[model samples]
Target chain A: MKYKVTESENISTVFLDGEIDMDVADNVREVVFPLIDSGKEVHLNLKGVQYMDSSGISVIVESNQRAKEKNTKVELKEVSQPVEKVLAMARKFL
Target chain B: MNTEATNLSEKKDFLVRSSSLKDVRSFSREVFEKFKIDENLREELVLAIAEAAQNIVKHAYKDYPDTQDRMAVRISCTDKELEIAFFDKGKPVEESKVKHRAIDDVKPGGLGTFFIQEIMDSIKFKEGDKPWINNLVLTKKL
Candidate 1:
């Protein structure tokens, strides 16, 4: 997966591209976690992401939990259709 | 490619590792497209198949990440039902212990099995005969 992060006053928006699976979940965490640790609201832009499995969903879940602990927030933006479908299924379990 | 073919079967094997999950999905999409499955359901089936394969790489072969084992995925379809089978030589799967984390328990790790259950109609685990240890079958009515 490829990512680009932009920072504004107190928020970091991470734009992720390519497929997010078990192979790339750690890389995603590496990119998104420290930003959350910085106590900034993080926006994960999923517009370029073509596919995401449970592993990807796990990253989002863990990030959200981490943000809550850090007194920040994580939001998903421009979620692609495929990812939206998977997220919908995951919402059932949440 | 016969889109109208009612009875179809395709099998492919990949080295058992997290990196091969993309290839698994590619093969699945090819088979589903050739079989003319609905576009709306194609991605869901792909997710279900990928999660099952991920389980093999994650749980069954947890300790053997660098091992040179291979797993096979077979997708077969008839006029009324679609069946996807996974054969892996990793550790044997314990059926009774394979439940997903409790619904109210919000966590990351156990959702793969939950997604499989949500997307597929049935899930069955069997002991493989030879050269394989775990056989997982997931089916959905068409």
Candidate 2:
């Protein structure tokens, strides 16, 4: 996966591109976790991401939990259709 | 427009590694397209297939990431149902211990199995005959 980050005063928007699976979940955590740790609201731009598996969802879930602990938040933005479908299925469990 | 025959089947083997999960999805999409499966249902099937494949890579081969093992995914469709089977030679799967975490526990790690359960009609784990150790079969009605 490929990612680009944009930072404002207190929020970091990460534009993630490519398919996300177990192979790339750790890399995603590596990218998003520190931003949450810095007490910044993180916005993940999923416009370019067309596929995300459970592993990717785990990253989102973990990031959300961690953001809550850090007193910030992580929001998903411009979620693609495929990812939206997966998220809809995951929402059943969440 | 799906005039293709319903009695279709395809199988492919991938290296049992996390990186091969993409290849597993790609192969599944190709077979689904060839089989003329419903457009709306294709991605869900792909996700189910990829999740099962990921389980093999993550759980079965947990101790041997560098091993050159390969796992096979076979997708077969009959007139009444679609069946996807996974054959792996990794550590034997303990059927009793394969349940997903309770929904009340809300966690990141167990969603794969949960998603599989949600998408597929039935999931069965069987002991493979030879050369393979675990046989996972997931089916959905067409």
Candidate 3:
């Protein structure tokens, strides 16, 4: 998986591409945590993401929670069919 | 690769083999489409199955570093519901402990199993010698 981080003004956008699975969870966490901790508004772009699993969902959810704590809002944008489905199902439980 | 022979002899098979989590979503979409599953239900079923399959890869086979020992996911559906099963040669999960976690938390990390249970109509886990099979059955009213 490949991720690129870009910041403009008060919003930080994380553009994710490729597959998000168990193998990439730790790497994703490492990249996302610092930016989130910096207390900037975050937006996750899933347009290029080809796949997603529970591990990936978990990472996103955790990031959302962290962002919430810092009063930073995290929004999901341009999600693919698969990632959108995962998020929808997750919303039922969370 | 003989194109003519391949086209003539090709059999339509729904089975998907995945070693990485990346393949799960795409495979789920293919299976859902083949079954003529509804658009709304297709979304839910894919997510539920993806999460279940990912858990099998992450926790069940954590000790096995080799890709050869990874889990296998099988999905089949009738007119009413989609059934997804995960087979792995790894440790069996404690059902009692898992059930407790389902109701306790709403956050992201520990709720994979719970989310699968709630999204799917029925969930069954079978544990035995050497290889353990975790099956998740999801039903969408069509």
Candidate 4:
């Protein structure tokens, strides 16, 4: 996956582009976690993401939990149709 | 449009690695398109197929990360139902140990199996006939 991050004051918006699976979940965490650890609100822009599997969903859930622990928040933005469908399937968990 | 015959089947084999998950989804999407499945349902089927394939890579081959083993995915569709079968030579799966965690647990790792169970009408684990060691069959009414 290719990602671009823009920082505006405290919030960092991460633009993730590509298919997300187990192969790329770690990289995604590596990118999004540090920002969350810094206690900054994070926005994940999923407009360019074409597909995401259960592994990717795990990253989102873990990130949300971690953000809560650190007193920060992670928001999903511009979720693509494919990714949204999977997220919808796991709505109760979220 | 009736783009395909009444009965259709396609199968593909891929390296049993996390990276191959994309190829698995691609193959599934292609087959669904050829079968003229609607977009929304097609995506759900692809997600179900990919999750099952991911289980093979994550659980079955957990010990053989660098092994050169490959797994096969077969999708067959008829007028009334669609069946997907996965063939792998990885560790034998004890059917008793293959349950998805409780949905209310709100955990990360176990959601794959939950999604599969939610999407497919029935899931069965059977012994492979030959060199293959594990076979998971999932079916849904089309």
Candidate 5:
């Protein structure tokens, strides 16, 4: 998967594309954690994500957790149906 | 055990093993098509199977470090419902300790089982066996 980060004042928008699976789980952790740990508002755009798996869901959930630790807000936008299902399922646990 | 009967029993035992996560979807699609399962139901079933299979590759055998034993996933579907079981000789998951950590709280793991249970009708885990098996069964009305 490919991810691009754009910073706008207080919010950081991360654009993600391609499939998010076990192979790319670490990449997500490396990219999103530091930003959340820095206490900046984060928005994840999943419009371009073609596919997702459980690992992908874990990454997003973990990112949200890190953001909470720093009092930063995180939101998800333009999530695809498949990606949405995974996210919705994750929401149930929350 | 008679020689003839043992050979017959061996032949009757069927196993379909796959290591590819992508195949999880493909396998689900094939089973749905072969059984004339509903289209909407097919998508749901695929999602459940994909999540379960991906969990095997991600958590069960995650400690390998070197992807040597990439993990194996086996699926069997019948007219009533679909059965998918993941076999990994990795560290056994402690059921009592296993809790669906809140997504909002965000820890790095623990969502796989929750997702599987959410999408599928039922889920069961067994680690008493030496190989450590996580078997999940999903059912949809015909």
Candidate 6:
């Protein structure tokens, strides 16, 4: 997956592209987690992401939980339809 | 999705590596398209299939990263249901050990199996006959 992190003031928006599976989960976490750890609110823009599997879903869940622990939040923004569907299904489990 | 179609079975083999996940998903999408699966459900099916494929790569073949093994995925659709089978020559899957973590537990890593269980109607793991070591079959009603 390809990603770009745009920082405006304190919020960091990570615009992720391509498909997210097991192969790219670590890379995704590497990109998104540190920003969350930075104590800044993070926004994961899924508009460019066309497909996401369980692994990708885990990244989001883990990020949110991490944010919770850090007293910050990782907000999902402009989630693509495909990702929204996956997230909806995953939410049933969460 | 009602009458069983006797005419739809397609299969493909890919290297048993994490990088092959996209190919696995692409193959699934193509087959689902030919089977005329609804566009909405097709992506869900693809996610299910890809998760199963990832299991084979991440769990079954976790020890053999450098080995040149190719796993096969077979998708068959009948009017009533769709069956997807995964064949891999890796560690034998212990049926009792194949459990997804409690969803409410909220964690990473184990969600792959959970997604598979959610998307498919039933899932079974069998001892692969001959050249294959593990056989995982997932079925979903159309």
> For model 4, how does the per-residue alpha-carbon lDDT over A2-56 read when each residue is reduced to its tens digit?
9999999999999999988888989999999999999999999999999887788
- How well does candidate 6 reproduce the true complex, by DockQ? 0.67
Output per-candidate TM-scores for chain A, rounded to 2 decimals.
Answer: 0.99, 0.98, 0.92, 0.96, 0.91, 0.97
DockQ of 3: 0.38
DockQ of 2: 0.66
For model 6, residues B21-106, the per-residue Cα lDDT tens digits are 99999899888877888777888899889889888887898799877999999999877788999999999998888888776564
Between prediction 3 and prediction 4, the one with superior lDDT is: 4
Q: Write candidate 3's Cα lDDT for B1-142 as tens digits.
A: 1122111111121222234554666677776666656676665676677677656654665576554655656666554445566666665676665551453343333566756776787777676435545433344334
DockQ of each: 0.66, 0.66, 0.38, 0.56, 0.33, 0.67
Candidate 2 lDDT over B1-142, as tens digits, reads 2645578899999999988989999999998888888888899999999989988988899899998989999999977789999999999999888877775454434688988999999999999879999999999988
lDDT comparison, 1 vs 2, better candidate:
1
C-alpha TM-score for every candidate: 0.96, 0.95, 0.69, 0.94, 0.70, 0.93
Most accurate candidate by DockQ: 6
Q: lDDT tens digits, residues A4-89, model 1?
A: 99999998999999999999999999999999998999999999999999889889988999999999999999999989988998
Q: In candidate 6, list every pair of residues with a backbone clash.
A: B3-B79, B4-B79, B5-B79
List lDDT for all candidates, in order.
0.91, 0.90, 0.66, 0.88, 0.64, 0.87
Residue A10 of model 4, lDDT score: 95
> Cα deviation in Å at residue B69, candidate 3?
1.9
Better model by lDDT: candidate 2 vs candidate 5: 2
For A1-94, candidate 2 gives per-residue lDDT tens digits of: 9999999999899999999888998899999999999999999999999899888888898898999999999999999999999999989887
lDDT, residue A89, model 1: 85
True-contact fraction for model 3?
Answer: 0.34
| Model 1: pairs clashing at backbone N, Cα or C within 3 Å | none
Query: Can you write out model 4's per-residue Cα lDDT over B1-142, one digit (the tens) per residue?
Result: 1445468899999999988988998899899888877676887888899889988987899899997999999988887788999999999999898877665454434688878988999999999989899999999987
Selected candidate, larger DockQ, 1 vs 3: 1
lDDT of 6 by residue, A1-94 (tens): 8999999998999999999888899999998889988999999999999998888888888898999999999999999999998888788878
